[model samples]
Target: MLSTAGRHIISGEHGLFRDQVRKFLAKEALPHLDRWEADGIVDRSFWLACGGAGLLCPSVPEALGGPGLDFSFNAIVAEELAYIGCNAGITLQSDIVCGYIEAFGSEAMQQAWLPSMLSGETITAIAMTEPGTGSDLKAMGTTVRREGDDYVISGAKTYITNGQNADIVIVVAATASEQGRKGLSLILVEATRPGFARGRNLDKIGQHAADTSELFFDEVRVPVSNRLGEEGKGFPCLMAQLPQERLSIAISAQASAQRAFDEALAFTKGRRTFGQPVFDFQNSRFVLAGLASRLQVGWAHLDWAIARHVAGELTAAEASAAKLFHTELLWECCDKALQLHGGAGYMNEYPIARLWRDARVTRIYGGTSEIMLEIIGRSL
Candidate 1:
């Protein structure tokens, strides 16, 4: 009964895992999202539940205590989460942060961290952006001075996702005696360390359920063994992982746009105005028609990019293009959907209002639209 596109999107073992994850989220996550949004953070219990359900770190290898799935499994989870307007933050931790560790972490580091991370006993966050640096990662001020057996880290990172509850943080810092990007190294800092402290949960215009905060490191000492990959290799490591991160953002954006369009369509069909259903109006019909066409094109592009990524053929430019186009289109869809809802869309009680607010951040995070353009332009 599924279309070819649907079948292609969810195939083989991934389809089974996708269905299971959907059911788990519908039952366990959706119900708690409102309360979590009010509290500005999802409870730790949800992370443990996701781990027990085999939803966290599904792509991790069996030797690391994971199900050994691929990135498609993570994409499915992202779609499901966005469909329900839930930014639970667990998906980011499991899908994005876990990839960084699995790909770049040393064998000993992976052995020590992967199992508990897969079990959701350990939460993780990546610190790259500083108060003065975001897309300009090379401008970071965090410094790590190497001692005989340890490295001393002192810096502050702002707008860090999952900062409040992360048990292990992948910190980007400049190694002493080196300059420019060559000095950068990735260090793992345990949250229980004395010098590591989390600032207040940031109050933002959207993504209320996802905890974004400022993190401070005051002379934190980490053993050199905690360094990820080789010294002075952090810049290249970050560059390599960015394509996947961009693709993840694109996946979320596409799903959010589709859900907004669906909600708008159902409302227009049922609501009457000027002695006829809103859908009967020529303006409403034309608007919905345009949105449907755009949605079809956007879905095709996303599916194509996803296929390339899974095949290991996707380029950085292709991933950046997907993120740029989908995020821009998502905001357009949200705004138009809100317009179609008239006064009801402006009310906080409506999901469209929330969707509209949430859509604004997609363009800003995971590398802004402008930064995406710069990356694309350099490829030409």
Candidate 2:
């Protein structure tokens, strides 16, 4: 009844871990949703609490302040957060950004950053997607050039999640613009740097509690030690890491869609119209039936993708396909669920309204559906 009933490929440890996360969110996070949404960000206290509960950076090795757990724990975190419609800012830090540092950073670099991240003493953001660049890394205008023992970075990054509160930002910049993507480099910039500035805590249509923003690096300088990997390997690193990122997105997409479905099913079964339950109506029945069918199939596919990812067999194209299918499915499920709510769905009071709004960006961010198709089509 919760959706994905048969689809969880969990061992005993994972099941216990999932329960712990579920309980933690319910007690520490869910109750404060309204206030956080109004403030446009979750409180830092909650992040600290999450870290205390062993919820952050589960996959990062213990030597680097992580629990050294598998990726399944990360997926569990992503799934549980989306299931409750909690803004996914935490998952972004743990699943996507942490993976980059863990996979590519030097030992000294990892030791410097990963501990604070694991403790939730620090917040992190990845600065890609500049104002004009969209998803094209080659067109990015951000530049990082060597100056003595430091690298000077100058550019703007927009649509950055966790931007308003990020203590550390992994910046994608061009070290040599003439080489196209070959010139790209990922620079680590502390938010307290002299020229690093955040533009605004962006007001968005939904997921208001998630702090998305614009960041500026106006000749920000950091030691050469701040670079994540090789000076010019940023694009390749991004490409390599994107499969996990996309899979993380797919997990949230599938979970949210299922949540929306559950909400609609409950509403249609209980709400009455014309002296009959809404579920008794033929149109409502058909709508729900179709959604249920799709959700079942979606869960199975999600499980398969998760399994492949666990085995290190999941390819970039497969992750793209998962992302494309699940995000589109999320949008559809939210839309139909909202429609079934009649008038209340449009009101902010209804969960469906926020779910609908939150689902919009899943298709846009993490590479748009068109970009996903392009990636997949190239392999055919």
Winner by lDDT: 2
- lDDT measured at residue 42 in model 2 versus the true structure, 0 to 100: 89
> How high a TM-score does candidate 1 get?
0.96
Output the lDDT of residue 158, model 2: 96
Residue 369 of model 1: what lDDT?
98
- Cα displacement (Å) at residue 189, model 2: 0.3
Worst 10 residues of 1 by lDDT: 1-10
- Local error of candidate 2 at residue 103 (angstroms): 1.1
Q: After superposition, how far is residue 7 of candidate 1 from its true place, in Å?
A: 5.1
Worst 10 residues of 2 by lDDT: 1-10
lDDT of 2: 0.91
How far in Å is the alpha carbon of 356 misplaced in model 2? 0.4
Residue-level lDDT of model 1, residues 1-380, one tens digit each, is: 11225535667777677678788887888789789989999898888888888888778988776788778888887887887888877667766788888898878888888888877788889998899988876677999988899999999999888999899999988884346787799999999988999999999998899899999999999899999888888889888888888899998898899888988988899899989999999999999999989989888888888889989999999999999999998999999999999999999888899899889999988899999999999999
lDDT of 2 at 169: 95
lDDT of 2 by residue, 27-78 (tens): 9988998899899988999889988999998999877767899888898999
List RMSD in Å for every model shown.
1.8, 1.1
